[model samples]
Target: MTDEPDDLSDQPPLVQALLLARYTLVIHSGMRAVSEGETWKLDFASQIAEIDAALQTAGIDTTKPMFAPVKW
Candidate 1:
């Protein structure tokens, strides 16, 4: 993927948030896999970090939840 900042302004805020969250989850999963007995090189981790940074720069609030907390 190009390193250009993703133009997520056209999407609804919730959709943009969800997409960012998905990318974040993918990076986290890769990190967990590497920590849990995986021997493959993790060269892509830096790229993932860059992407997450770009997403944040694009104004998506990565720290906020997309949905309300369940009361149950």
Candidate 2:
């Protein structure tokens, strides 16, 4: 990927926190429901896919460490 100015690390702290929280909730709930033999909802899976797409489109490096030392 070419060097992109807009990366996940470039986002504000609050935005990062919110995104992480949302991701955690969705993944945790989805896993629990599946493990309990509950019918999995496609909506949750779609949301995750959407999130992944959005992140990728935003030039965010999903493969790298999200929290790195910020040199101020």
Query: The CA-based lDDT of model 2 is what?
Result: 0.54
Model 1 regions more than 4 Å off: 1-43, 65-72
Give the lowest summed-lDDT range of ten residues in model 1: 62-71
Per-model TM-score on C-alpha atoms = 0.35, 0.42
Across 1-72, the per-residue lDDT of candidate 2 in tens digits comes to: 544333446677755754575456464653533556666543465565666666667665544434333457
Among residues 3 or more apart in sequence or in different chains, the pairs in candidate 2 whose N, CA or C atoms overlap within 3 Å are none
In each prediction, how many residue pairs overlap at the backbone (N, C-alpha, C within less than 3 A)?
Answer: 0, 0
lDDT of 1 by residue, 10-65 (tens): 56786566565565555455442345675654345555566557667777654543
9: Cα error in model 1, Å: 11
Evaluated at residue 25, the lDDT of candidate 1 is 56
Give candidate 2's error at residue 45 in angstroms: 2.5
Clashes of 1: 0
Quote the lDDT for 23 in model 2.
55
